[model samples]
Target: MPGRYTLAKSVLSERKALHPSELERRDLPADAARAVRSLAAEISVTLDANAATAATLTDPALLHHIDTRYRELPATVHEAMRPPAGDTGVTIIGSIPLRDDELGRTPIDWQQAAAWAGHPERRCASYELDIVMLLLARCAGEPFGWQGQQAGRLVNNILPTPGKEHEQSGASSTTLLAPHTEDAFHPQRANLLMLGCLRNPDLVGTTVSSVRRVELDAAQRDQLSRPLLPILPDVSYGTDFPDAETPPIPTLSEVDGQHIFRFDPAYTPLDDADLDYRTAYARLTSELERVCIAAALEPGEVLLVDNDVVVHGRVPFSPRYDGTDRWLKRVNIRLPQRLRPAAEATETGYGQCVVAPFRTTLGIHT
Candidate 1:
């Protein structure tokens, strides 16, 4: 029932519709849909067996894949990436070079890519990006999703988009990024974030991440797991505009004795019960400073971050206002078996959020 949904009688009965993005307006084209189905089938076979019902769930094969492919990074590099001595919440595998066959190139802009949505991978190095997502999901033992527009640039190309960008230079003018999760507004969020660097700006823009180190004592663990902390989203991230009124979700959620975390200091609102909020915040900052490593990824190098356990940020990137600028591609995925449904199935119930749209809408009428 938690993953089920009831269908609305008709379009008129549907609640107010949220404005869909230009990309969302056009659902996956036939070929893309077929590709996704194939991918899904592959995932179902690899995962789905002995998955966790509530808390931590992982497939043995998935772990083995991560351990094996992780060797792509040098032993020294991987060892250097361990989240400090006391840290355990996050693990970062850096600068894993993909096979030459695994790499693809993107078009100069989004318009060209959209015209051939049916062959998305053909549009813009998307096939390579897809492989990156697959690897990350396989590592996290979680299913993931492709996020935003495949070929879209991080910043608006024509006019600078929101969240303050250097006007003349077209670079990030600010140094400090407000801490926040990638897509808190969406119920169906990406489980992992894969960043592939196409260019670097002034050799800056180092990534910063915070994690609740595993060595915390019982008291610290309790503090990390304290109930009902408000998670406020940065206004720039999305329209939800989270505030104090939004009930707090767990920053650290556990199941089957395995702990998982979803934290964004910028968006996470504080409640009275959050006694160690400041301490946790301070410790995280210290850990990030001490453990943060930078990889000036070449065109073919990709970095994968565990989203559920790691909060990521970027140091300021100074743009030169030239065609050559810092560029990175991101993709997200979800492990369906790890997710819990909001409610139980009724006589007529909607499925999980990802599939619920089919229940009330004219089944992919788009």
Candidate 2:
């Protein structure tokens, strides 16, 4: 059988050969788009008046207020924004109005943004995008994030940094990001992943594959359902944490009668001794590649992915060290009831798991 790295490279090669034209695309209705823009504009004004920073904007109290306001949107707007039903496992909302000039000029220095208290201009753009994501997330479920990841920021900036662009991370530009579930190593992975594009001058496409689109036989399905896969944490979650690995969990499981997946090819290690598991894993990877779709999100466009049903990645693209590069803000969402006990304390605020010994290992006698 082929090694995991070989399978990953094969899939990436196939994905790279395809263009965005081959995949499906959807635009928001004009009326719905207008409503969203109007709402975003109103929220921007409020944020500006309050002198909201990223930290303040994501405050639990402020989030509640935003959620309440979103609920009050016209019923027609909500209806129009409803995602189409199918196996795609994604919804693309386009034509949102973002007044870049008013927000602020794009920052050229990533290190400066990291060092400064905050980038006022970039913060404004993030604030506007966050409102849109929060509205959409509330419609689907509650939005959340991890304190361990992305410095506990609710709105994560995904842009290529000078030193990190070639690495395999969200901030990596030249590397082909392997398709995986966001935070797959964590049991409290979000039910929905929201990405709002602030800028994409190069028009890079995001690759997505849905489990619903794969054809699995009973044997393959049963093999994958067994708790034989061990997933490791992504590097985004700083290295200071313990090296504990996840308890053996199935890559695929049925939740509420719907097929759900927990897979990260880069992090999930395969058991060399288990032939059935290895064969099933390879077959699943191939199927994902066969049905994969690419989406090139534009400025003012947001993509909502059903986290449980789909795996997503990014295609490699050249990034100019200049200010104009692909920039996106991401937020993870889950139903309030689905909040894990370990993360409860942080869930109401900037979501983070504060407790130590964070991972639960399987098969340990303890």
Candidate 3:
């Protein structure tokens, strides 16, 4: 088995270089940006140090106590969490206050924090951030994770690492991440994905594009709705997971009038014989990039993405690796009813789901 860096190097060696100027970029609307900044300021002042401390306590009893306390948050904070009316699939809550100095430098080693059993010392400010995410997610659905993904941690760290900066994984910092749904290979992928920034000194933006924003003709939409696409597991899932030869699945489906999408351009293999599917997929990816929105999240800010409706990726940025680079904490959420039967018992209380057997031969999970 090779190291993550080796795998990243191999992948990078085969790809052509990307020019930064060719990338797409967009900012939040002025009104929405202003509202979020103001709300974050107010929440910073309202949140007490005690709340931060309570967030770090993982005891079930203590977590319950903290949950009760957060439920009593001021009306203003609650209102800020709600997105403005419309069909936008991505929500940005910026300028939330974080005591970065107290949190110290970015971690050089990922294993310490990426483990299923979390690191206590790393929770200083991220713990409070996760509490906010948990509350927001509870309003819509339950948060979850996979035991085989990012060590099955509820709050996974997103940052650039030494050798993985060019890989398609979230740890990559210098590579263009092809837009895709989070863990699209799974049947029970998250309904919502939440990202909380801890340190983004360079102001790197996360790219997001929604299905609602992408214009498609009736024929194209119909083509995409057919079961003709095969999505592979993310590199982070390691190579040992099973079911790699599963049948092709639909990229888009309508359930109760709501559209659901599963896509990963980097991982999904193209079938030259299926001309219609290939053409439709190409158009879909192009539309997604055309309407892509880049949100530069700052410390204390959180971005909530409707994974079922939109695909997301990050812009390429150089990593200094000086322990002051970009850093974020991520979590996945799914409605309880959406939890698959096979993963229910294992993922219920704890977010750890059973990894499928597909693509287990890659030995990348290590």
Candidate 4:
């Protein structure tokens, strides 16, 4: 994995696609942003005094305490953040009242961020902002983390590493990140992805394409609905699930008359798929590109993507790595308490597990 990259495929057609300007009124209203800051400031004091440890931050009791404060937000904010319906499933919330100078420098990589909580002296200045993200995620679902990703931090930082600019993971910089599900391979993948901006000096775009916006013929749709391919782990999680009966992943499924899809071409084993299935997958990829739009976020803004209804990626940008480059904090959210029943006979846990210690507290069943 080199530090520089060029995308292997194009994510948009020759006709210029929509930019952040095209994404209408998803920004958080000024009044709501003020309310959010007041709430976060009050909670940050409580967390600093009592949280004591990072693990305690995820404790159910604390979460409940924090969640209760969500009522302080404007009712209009609640209505706006409702589970997306019949739309692009992409929401860009701006105006969170952040201080640019307090953000410090973006970490060189996620690995460095993993150690921030342990050493208070090296603590991230974005803890207040992180609390804002946690509060916002609760409006929709429970925020969660993986066993091996970013040392299992509930809120992970998205930044470019000098040595990982060409990888398929979030650390990539110069390479174009093709839109895909947050974690398509696993059945317990996030239903929603919350990306909050701390800084984006160069105005890097976070690309998003929803399944609802894609176009496909009847036959192609049918083929993809039936295609079952294994999307392996990306470089971020270097683990192998050696299960003899691992169920294959279907790129698309319809539930209650709505289409839901999980696609990650970079990790998918397309070579193992049948020619008909491969052809359909390629078509789906193109369709996603056709509808893909880039939401170039700035400081104090956040982007929430429906992981089930949309696939997301990052556009190529040069990272200075000088502490002032683009930086965003990310969180994985699980909505719909009990997950959809496994698509097959076996439990499709896929050998990976979540670190959501408060699942029971949140009324989520395994």
Candidate 2 structure quality by residue, lDDT tens digits, 167-197: 5578787888889898876666776788888
Output the TM-score of candidate 1. Answer: 0.51
Collision count of model 1: 26
On TM-score, the leading prediction is 4
Residue 332 in model 4: shift from native, Å? 1.3
- Deviation in Å, model 1, residue 354 alpha carbon: 5.1
lDDT of 4 by residue, 7-73 (tens): 2366453232324444544666788888877777676656543323442246454566566877777
**What shift in Å separates residue 269 of candidate 3 from its native position after superposition?**
1.3
User: lDDT of candidate 2?
Assistant: 0.64
Error of 3 at 40 (Å): 16
Per-candidate Cα RMSD to the true structure, in Å, reads 16.0, 6.1, 8.9, 3.8
Model 3, 1-366: lDDT tens per residue? 123111211111112222123222223344544444343334433544343233332335433533454455444445545432235577665545456784566775456443312344454444545555555544445555567765544557787888887778898988877688998877667777888788888778787778888889988998987776456677787654333454567788766566778887766666422888778887887788777767677776777777878888887889997878888888676654432332212222222254221112211111
TM-score to native of every candidate shown: 0.51, 0.80, 0.73, 0.87
The TM-score of predicted model 4 comes to 0.87
* Model 2 steric clash pairs: 247-362
Predicted structure 3: lDDT: 0.60
Ranking by lDDT: 4, 2, 3, 1
